[model samples]
Target: MSLKSTVIFLLSLITVMAKAQIDTAKIKSYADQVMVRVNIDTNIERYVFTEGPEDKPLETILSINNKTRASFSVDYKIISGTVSFTPNFLPGNNDNELKGSSSYADFRFRFFPKKIIQTVYYKKVKGFYIENMQDFFPEWKEGKDAYLQFPDLKIQSFGGSTAYVMKKDFSLKSIYTQGEWQKESRGSWVPVIDYDLSIFTDIIDGRKNRDTQYSIGASMGYFYNWVLGKKNRVNIAPNVGLGLGGMFSSTRDILDDGTKSSKENTQYLTIRFATGLHIGYNTDRLLFGGKFNVTSSAYNEKGNQNVQNNNLYGLIYIGYRFPPPGVVKRNYDKIQKKIPIL
Candidate 1:
């Protein structure tokens, strides 16, 4: 039992099994150096106070990268912005004709985490329309040359939400949106004895009407960061938000003896708001941005009805910042907490 004490205990058990197999191959080469990025965004939504003729925006977005927080992100959305009206209804001294716009491509789910981060969402939207239908059916417009002309309409939506974030910028958002909207076009107001004042058209046949909505909301936001020059990374952020919620609406129309007239699903009370102005330019491997946003929604159903919708958008982004995946830090500089969130 003495061959140099068994060769120094077999060389201290082969130096502890070669330092535990070189720390399990540096933790499998730091989980195969994980670092992923992908993003695409395009937007357009504006009301600006509403007036008429001006519509074209279907919203499109795609993103990925939450490798446990790369500024957080996991979103995918496709929106059918809005605009459609063929011959739904017109009677108050008519004049209607203008059909060339429609959209539909439902599918939405979001989890945008930075810039005050924290957001969870779900949506199932469908063909949205109605921006300034003569400021909401002013008897289908009478005065100004009896205005009314919208084509192709059908809207639907589904929803879900959860949000919470603190300090790292500040944000609190909650949401839920249910939907169903429709449009119909038939004939009305007879008068063609021998006096030109034509007002009746349905190009390819039509008759459909529906409106239903369910909403919930909550908002509170703030973001502040102004780093510029001198390797400060040139970044600027400004944000604001407000919220209130309640909405339940239903309206169905179709009656000329075929009997079908509904409009009792009322439960309104809503207010939502948003504002943003952000600019970015980070390096270590590119990251650029230019964002300008303003949004609002107000609805108070009942006598003297009050409805409001205002949205303005602008967003351009380009990203790529992968260079930090190299570890096994040989004791990670004697361990000093470097974002290993666990």
Candidate 2:
């Protein structure tokens, strides 16, 4: 199906299923309060390229130098948003001499409409160096030898996902945003549809080259929240998802003579996997938590070349909940009156 048709179908399905009754006794909602959070995370984006025989393959791993990031987030009612950036002052994040300079930025927003969860995000990353230099240089030393760097390489991506909860008692929000809390342990199967558009640009021998890719996938995920403590203040949640999709990519390269050659609409099969675990302490006014997550996607090109994009991160966050100021609430209410979905 076309991408637009698929999106429409998913929205219709979500709207139909949202009318189903939910068990209020199993979950607690904090919609009347505003939540503000600060998060510190060790998130890294990496790409792996491999070729040659299956028994013995040649591999290259490209990664950025920044190893730490900080984010601020806010949530009110059904809406949540976050902004994140790499902090160069953090220890281990500013090794620019050996790894070349790098920059990263991310913005994300989410909406919860009953049993459906919707998310949209944008990310930009620049500069990368080969992390495993020893694989190519036999005499390379970790601290003494400088790895290969790509300071001109840049990547930007836009992506979103739509997910639906299959169980009425399960609370996905409790694990993701802490907008709610689950009083009892529960598990649910969630179906998700996700899509992305990405652009990659790099300069080689003073010539600029660009590639654009588009992809969409549908996946089934299983999530379980195990609530603990006598007061149900602590919880552990684990989830996993697997999916298959297709990637359509186009490339343009500047030739040595200053002419541009373009290749359009090359298609490849893609495989995706994601898993995460979250553990947190929750109360009516305060919350704190930690989480670890990994996501990966791989696709093969002609001549046995395989490329994989892998993201792995660990995050710790502390948050506080408070009543919204009267002016803020009044303004939100006025906006909601017109939109009804806020």
All candidates' lDDT scores? 0.37, 0.89
lDDT of 1: 0.37
Using lDDT as the measure, which candidate wins? 2
Please write out the lDDT profile of model 2 over residues 1-342, one tens digit for every residue.
863564455445434434432445389999889999999999889999999999999999999988799999999999999999887788889788889898999999999998999999999999999998999999998878787999999999999999999988888999889999999877778999999999999999898999999999888887778778999899987777779998999999988898889686699989987778899999999999999998889999889899999999999999999999999899999999999877
Clashing pairs in 1: 84-151, 85-150, 85-151, 87-185, 88-184, 113-117, 114-117
Candidate 1: tens digits of C-alpha lDDT, residues 1-342: 863564355345434433332211100111112122332233333223222323632221211110010122221111112221222232311222221233223233433333222222332212223334445565554334422333433333445444444432221111110010001111111111111111111222355565666677666544333345765455454555567777666666655566777665667777776655566654545556666666677774444344565545555555443433245334443342563421
Clashing pairs in 2: none
Error of 1 at 301 (Å): 17
What C-alpha lDDT, on a 0 to 100 scale, does residue 112 get in candidate 1? 36
User: Which residue segments of model 2 deviate by more than 4 Å?
Assistant: 1-25, 255-259
Instruction: Give lDDT: candidate 1, residue 101.
Output: 36
Candidate 1 residue 86 Cα shift, in angstroms, is 21
